[model samples]
Target: MAAPDELFCWEGAWGLPSVSSDCLTVLAYAQFAGAPLKLRKISNPWRSPSGSLPALRTNQNETLSRPADIIIHLRKQKFNADYDLSAREGADSLAFISLLEERLKPALIYNSWVDSKNYVEVTRRWYAEHLPFPLNFLLPGRMQRQQLETLRLLRGEESLEGGEELEKELYREASDCMNLLSQRLGARKFFFRDSPSSLDAYVFAYLAPLLKAKLPNGKLQQHLKSLENLSSFCSNILLLYFPHDARESSGGQKSSSPPQPEGGDYDHVPNKRRKQLMSVLVALGAMLSYAVLTGILSIQHMQKEALEAPPPDRQTLDPLDEDEEGDG
Candidate 1:
């Protein structure tokens, strides 16, 4: 028997199995196709062989990072979610997925990364809390930068300046896309009426995050919730395919405490004490380095001070010895 492929992906949060839309797409597709995989849920992307999340390490030793490439590779292994899709259905799938990318993706990026409130409170805080030490200090900001760049590219602009005008345009297109999807999915259990397909995976990935996340600024989320069918669609998929995560999400909501980091699987506070120690050490080292670099505290200066200090009172020691002889 061949060894199962290993999938490294972002840890789940917000009751969704993986916070990343791309990772959710791949995961849902794999589940729909019945592909057996060893899942390695991780908060740190650097742990993945490809140095990114949603990476696949095949039994053949090939590592794939992009979700599209990973899906293509899975199809080659006869794990195809779209195998049952009719020719017209397949064409429709491509069209709708394209529509989502062109219309909805920019909005998702904006709300998650470019929107100041959501980025600071929900998105950045989630990753920063879940990510292991040192990286926790750096990667969230870097990821935001990358997401912003991606959003700019999607908008076909050399640079993006967030404003009320830009927000209105993005939300308008996103709402239009959601309405279209809801109309197409009117009363069906799945996009194709019965069986799940890649289209289902794609739509679910995009909508689930927006629906489930507790964003401070949730204009898109409110619109999605108003579309009853689309909201049910995401909920149904979560219950059917990802029951464990669904349970976790429900449990988290009922509790008074804040949601724990990634469900005790990925950096789940097992190394929290160690990370705290390392964080303190790193902070101290940084402070010491800064002091030395700025000439505030110098090793050579301390050494010179020690060397120039007056010798201890040899006469004082001799007086104690002389007093002892007199007593004798």
Candidate 2:
């Protein structure tokens, strides 16, 4: 396989050179396509035209930023790894990709950022390891806010200030998308059956980290574990293609060993997160209104006092009110 000119992306974590899902998506395609990609890790997203990672500069000096665009460019250049699907199958693939992109992406953001436990333990730590100190501090938070904003905009909502309901809805939507993918894959060797498609790369990219990471919330992890075929599908892919990482993860074992939870010791934490978001927002608005009203009333009272009272020296001092009882 001829080497790629260069691929620019965020550095990896968990003993990887490129740990990001998007970065891995691109790498996985290149692998399946027999494209030899040389990775160039970048700390700053500004290095790319879209201010994002996983940008590729091809042998012909064409710069592509997005995964779909990169794959299209590769196909056009006759390095064709893209599935030559029938019109119906192609449409189906496109729909599935959109589902993963729009719905699944936000769920990932929730796992990494909104989930307090995952953010502190896994996501933040991973990003911090790859970034400079201050940037490590700022970037994770900035990413969280940006993803939250994106979710808000996608849902056609105004603010994420009281977004618990939205967050819950997003989680459900993501889970549904996952289940749909699982059903579609449905014991097939690959989504396209024996011939891997670009969607397979995306599947591996998104699931790899979540499945492996020892996160605190464990909801996302648990949800993934529930999908038996999906788990096997991911494991099988790594064992077949990425034998090194797969073998290392399995302690030098050639085959993929799906990690098992011991003896039904899983925590079924009741999602106590309530649906009182609207109430909370309304309460806050009321408090703000009360504060404004109080301020206005206070100003009016001050004005009345000023009008009713004479200047101190000119006023007759009431004996009952005089503190010192001076010369009574």
Candidate 3:
């Protein structure tokens, strides 16, 4: 029997294992190692000892939090899965995974949270599904604010700014990163030749969400698609390891993607009507908020006008001053 009773993780998106790359990495590690385990979906990480999802709690009363740590633990203690990796390969995998975490993670946050439409329509709703009622109402906002603040600090900006220009820049950087990975992969099945090292799981965890998500700022996804070899690698791994999520392009599926859970289709996060309604609501709210901000400025301008004296005209000007102007 597998030691872990439940692998806690964020919920799936479009039938993928998880929307969270961290969760995906841990889960993929288990799957690739052929470890027996159960998945536990969650909306928030408040209950976790590490205060994060993707926690691995074992039946032996051991708890592991953070995907990287969980994967390492699995390899060393649970699966002994890295026997194929030589000292050199293991060192390379370690360095590559670190690079992926540092570069790709912020871009994921930027695309999902900084993009208004995606946050309102997709990310918010998806998160809301997992939390209790009142927390559901507030936590998403708090999380979004955190993401925005992080972006501002990253960009060295004083105020929140979200638009296509920012997305364009972020996605360009992301595209370059993907292109480099694609070149690294070339014609190989995984990062280190045919065998999937720990690096592949980490990469797939990050890429799967981007590839499957239908976010408003889909430039990230578009960049992934343009790298055909990278797309194939993800598809092949999804088919081999996460067959339930491989419905879209996998050949000869025994069945379609995991049947939509009770209550709604995950792709739309309930139904078409609700998603449309959310879209309209987001658009209206954005316009209203913009108007309010500008309206405050306009109101302040009018108040200034009311307080300040009018510009001096000929009636208010003295003859001496007029002569002074003429002389000058």
Q: Please report how far candidate 2 places residue 220 from its true position, in Å.
A: 2.1
Tens-digit per-residue lDDT, 1-328, candidate 3: 4454668887766758777787888888888787777777776777654567878887876788867677767766658456688899889887877767566766788878877777876798778876765688888898899888887776675455556677777677777778889988888898886677778888888898888776765768888988999988987888888887666434322344356443344464445687588779999999999998989867766866786754455337777788899999
**Residue 11 accuracy (lDDT) in model 1:** 99
Best by lDDT: 1
Give residue 205's error in model 1 in angstroms.
0.5
Give the lDDT of residue 202 in candidate 2.
86
Tens digit of lDDT per residue, candidate 2, span 169-247?
A: 7778888888998999998888885777787888888887777666778776788889988988877777777776665
Model 3 worst lDDT window (10 residues): 248-257
| Per-candidate total of colliding backbone pairs | 0, 1, 0
lDDT of 1 by residue, 1-328 (tens): 8999999999999999999999999999999999999999999999999999899999999999988899999999999999988899999999999999999999999999989989988898899889986898899999998998888888886468658888899999999999999999989999995889999999999999999998878889999999999999999999999999999989977872355543433445446798789879989999998888898446656765787743366447877999999999
* Estimated TM-score for each candidate: 0.82, 0.69, 0.70
For all candidates in order, the CA lDDT equals: 0.91, 0.73, 0.76
CA displacement after TM-score superposition, residue 321 of candidate 1 (Å): 49
Ranking by lDDT: 1, 3, 2
Q: What is the lDDT of residue 26 in candidate 1?
A: 95
C-alpha positional error of residue 68 in candidate 3 after TM-score superposition, expressed in Å: 1.6
